[model samples]
Target: MEGLALILLYLAIPGLLFSALQRFLAGKKKSSSTAKFPGPEQYPVVGRVHDLDRFGMWLKFKEWADKYGPIYQTRMLNQPFIIVSDEKIAEELLVKRGHIYSGRPQIRSLIKHKDGPAYSALMDRHDIWKTQRKWCHAAMAEAYKHHFYGHVEMEMKRYLGLLLLDPARFLDYTREYCGRVMSRLAWDEATQGKANGESADQTLHCMSVSGPITNTMTPLWYLPAFANPWYNFEVKRESEQRAWWLNNLRLAKDRYRRGELPNDTWAYRYFEQIQREGNETLEQAEDQEIFASCMIGFLNLVGVVTISGPLKFFLMAMGLHPEWQKKCQDEIDRVCGDEMPTMANFADLPTVRACLKETVRWRSGVPLGVPHQAERDDEYRGVHIEKGTIILACEWSINRVPEKYPDGDNFRPERYLEPGWPTYQEPLTRYPNFREGHSMHTFGWGRRTCLGQNIVDDEMFVFGAATLWAFNSGPKTCPRTGKVIPIDTTATNAHVILEPSPYQMEFKVRSPERGKKVLENYHSVLGKLKL
Candidate 1:
């Protein structure tokens, strides 16, 4: 009788907790039952996989958004995909339910690199991801306090010197500047004069486009390479690239071993932290090597690839809108005078900040923010989202939503200003000073937000303010016709990162004295940096 009583007690208490877990898991499954999930026509076998083959994923996704409204579901190679285009839906899924929406899709290309999948930013939520993110945040915060604006200013003014010399080669100039600064920050190595293809930035650009294309063919990743031409070629190519990057990573690691790399650099801190954990053991050594490889790719993604697209767009915005450009220059002149803008004085330059913010929103770089995965079965807005479904949080469509941003298509920074400016700010502007997803969704939201946002802000500010202070961007004249070269504001590059076309714009130095002063200041800053 006593034994029976004890069994009953145990079952009654512990079983209650078990039942509660069951109910919780049940709720997580079947997110939406009654609501209809909408999308374009899908074939029986291929589902909408052919859409990607026909047009870029982003372009087709945008096209479908118009037809199917904001929330839609489709399949790629028989895999479930949920695309969120509306701001409300994106916030609901990506922010409120970030825990279940933070997983990364299984992309073979991302994993094929020596330490590819180990890259915390691109990989799924794991212990390593959490650790790396913590380090990144701490590193950026420290950099923000000490070296943020001044370091980038050194790079930007140097970039301006190049721009002054050959404004027509803006493309190469931007690539080189981003490369040099990022190389210094990531590896503590100076690469200011590295040739175009040799710079780390150029390599990152080539790799950036690979992710999108490779993801679509993930269903074929494991088949024998001999059976697939594309697979064989990419594997060999990525292998070679990975080896080169890993060697570079080891060089940086060697510096750390010798106590040569700057202790302040994020990469250096990362290496030092792991080393302190007793990385002499075999497993720890392997982990260290993997992390070193991952960072090589991470720096490329966040440091170089992340900022280039919007940076080009920012310059294009200045060329297209000179009145706003003039106001920005006037504010910079009033606040900073002839001195270069530093992080210490950044608070005073709200106009430049707003302009930078607008550029991010206006021509958002990443349309579908690095696809995330759903970890569990869930329902939203009466629609079902199954476990392991791909989530494309569409930054492009959400930013363009007319309800939130009236006249959203235009580039207007005044919308970010407070109070009065009858023509530009407050009541006259829709969503005045509004900050969505941490000052526009360009950096993404929640767990996937940019690891390098501080760097992005500093780069945009230095480049924008420095250039506006020194030059006037206007339509270039056609040498043959002697007519103003028509600029195509709408022409853009392929999906993912939206880049402006090669538009005709002449950047004239504001004055010879100021131009000379800018170069002189650049030389002085570089000397102080010992570069």
Candidate 2:
């Protein structure tokens, strides 16, 4: 019995030693890899979690960038995040080495049912994401070739008339116009002149309620279902949204079958592509998969607010800096000459284009870009980045880089017009073209960049040109004091997307002839649309 006990003790001693050695080696490797990076001091376990604030987090990120240099690391719980403030670094890592960095982190609040279809662009880099992205690009390309500009023109005219009729609701009209145009392109349901307000409300609610909560660097999401009310709410919200989207999908499919939907509608183009391919190269051929892919058009309803934010900024800039507005109006008048602005006139109106570019740069909608996840272990400039690290490109900081944009806090379209500025290009006639990739970082970088960028450019140019041509926006005067109310450029940080805090401005027609022309164009389009 004594000999047997001695033999067992010897075996257990070696096993314990081996496990201890493995843990020591792992700790050494982790320490060595992360030692070179600069960041705020981390606390044990919590690891900078307390530093996160729901509001002005991007500002805090920028402050960190100023302190820690362009690239730095921050940890929350066990997750490591790399915050990138320089565009060059972003291009190198996210664009040049995109294959390794194009993955999306798992957003706990946005998780769909275990068996439900997922948003394609939001999904991590995989077979499903690839297939759905291909379908979306194909459908968008087809729609662009057919009826994209026509829809934008019609909607802009309608929006201008609405603005003239009720300038007090300009922001509301902006959102409605965006929603209507997207709805028309997505499902051809906007000819009835009603915006998809419900979808817009759903998107806003989801973003407002879940965005701030999930964006934090805590492990609140890991709480058990019994203890997590947000988790339960999100589950129910996602289920309802799924039903709403699926119902819309069914209605669109039914309309397509009845030949009621136009060939140019996104639904028609998507369905046609599916039929044409006939599963030859398709992997996800199930109804849910098709719905998920086709729903990119519906998902673009999120752009309604995103685009409206920039347009509101444009209005604010116009009111605050009337000189720039006058410059744009002069350019538009020279280019279009009393006629409504169109894509054909885009090249001749560089000032208008520059204003649009500057507005987005001044107040980016998605300040902290959607986080990207590292797919595999990699090294950049001797800094080790492990797999599953979250990469955040602080776009607000990137746009404000002093070297690229001088006086970045102020609104300045001249940056893109003058040769001294980093953003400027030669040949003044066509320098600041939005569609030619002039504002790349504003949308995003690499494969996960916003798919609706081209549409955004087109919509903004036409809407901006027409607005500047028709109205002169300025700060409203207080009736009691007869003083101009200052337009606060401060933005709200309720969600990931940033919008200017509620402000008032007065938009007046530049001339009665312009006002008459706006009404004429609106009535003419209204008649044709009714038919």
Q: Estimate, for each residue in 222-254, the C-alpha lDDT of model 1 and write its tens digit.
A: 446664444665556556655655666677777
Winning model by TM-score: 2
What lDDT score is found at residue 447 in candidate 1?
79
| TM-score of every candidate | 0.82, 0.87
Over 68-180, each residue of candidate 2 has an lDDT whose tens digit, in order, gives 99999987655678999998899999999999999877665666411224466567776666766677777666666643848889888888898899999987787677777
TM-score of 1: 0.82
Ten contiguous residues with the weakest lDDT in model 2: 209-218
lDDT of 2: 0.73
How does residue 323 of candidate 1 score in lDDT? 91
Off by over 4 Å in 2: 1-34, 113-116, 146-149, 191-218, 222-227, 278-286, 289-294, 297-299
Local accuracy by lDDT, each model: 0.66, 0.73
Q: After superposition, how far is residue 410 of candidate 1 from its true place, in Å?
A: 1.2
Superposed on all Cα atoms, the candidates' RMSDs to the truth, in angstroms, are: 11.6, 8.6
lDDT of 2 at 251: 79
